[model samples]
Structure formats: C-alpha cells, structure tokens
Target: MYYPTIRGCIQALKNLEIWLDKAEQHAAAKGFDVGVLLTSRLAPEPSSIS
Candidate 1:
C-alpha cells in the first residue's frame, strides 16, 4: 500500500518536471518569458474559488 502511494508521488513529480521543461521550450519558441507560464494559475484569482 505505502509502496504504491510513494511510487505514485514520484511519478507525479517526474511528470511535472517534464511538463515544466516543455513549457519552457514552448515559451522560448513563442518569444515570451518562461516565468509567465511558471507563475500562471488555473484560476484568474484565488478569491474567485469558492
């Protein structure tokens, strides 16, 4: 049980790293700052969430 949970967490971290790298490459291709993507949120504002 614990093994599977730990494995899942590690896998998720690895996937996040891959996604961040891709986002950086995409930002460079579009000539925008990678920080823009890094700092972006799923919602326009945190207060908007209920």
Candidate 2:
C-alpha cells in the first residue's frame, strides 16, 4: 500500500525534474535567463486588505 504511494511521489518528482530540464533548454533556445523560469509563479499573490 505505502509502496505505491511512495512510488507515485518519486515519479512525480522525476516528472518535475524533466519539466525543469525542458524549461532550461527552452530558455537557452530563446536566449532568455533561466532565472526567469525559476522565479515565475503559477498562482497570483494574495492581495493584502487595506
């Protein structure tokens, strides 16, 4: 039971690594800084109430 869960987590991490590699390749091809990809956010920052 736990083995499958652990395997899934490892697979997800591997997939993330592959995606990051692809992102780096894309940045190189586009002549952009890899930091741009590293610093990007998927969700908008929460606004503070005044």
Candidate 3:
C-alpha cells in the first residue's frame, strides 16, 4: 500500500514538473510568471458517510 501510494505521489510530482515546464514556455512567450493551480488538490473534501 505504502509503496503504491509513494509511486503515485512521485508520478504526480513528475507530472507537475512537466506542467510547470510547459507553463514556463507559455509564460516566456507572453512574458509572465508561471505557476500551477493547486487549489483542486488543496481544498477540503466531503467525508464519506457510509
């Protein structure tokens, strides 16, 4: 379980890095700072009731 979770986290991190790279390229073309929208992951979620 831990191993799979760790691997998933690592993959997510790699994807974030790739996203940032693309964002940087886009920003450079328009001369602006690059960043990611982490709100989706940071926001609280509803608890399961069942």
Best by lDDT: 2
Ranking of all candidate structures by their lDDT, best first? 2, 1, 3
The C-alpha stretches of model 2 lying farther than 4 A from their native spots are 48-50
Clashes of each: 0, 0, 0
Clashing pairs in 3: none
Clashes of 3: 0
lDDT of 3 at 34: 55
State the local distance difference test value for candidate 2.
0.94
Give the distance in Å from residue 10's predicted Cα in candidate 2 to where it truly belongs: 0.9
What overall lDDT, based on C-alpha atoms, would model 1 receive against the true structure?
Answer: 0.93
In model 1, what are the clashing residue pairs, if there are any?
none
Strongest candidate by TM-score: 2
Residue 19's C-alpha lDDT in candidate 1? 98
In model 1, the runs with Cα more than 4 Å from the true position are: 46-50
Output the better candidate (2/3) by TM-score.
2
lDDT of 3 at 15: 100
lDDT of 3 by residue, 1-50 (tens): 99999999999999999997887788789885554433235645556333
Q: For candidate 2, which ten residues in a row score worst on lDDT? A: 41-50
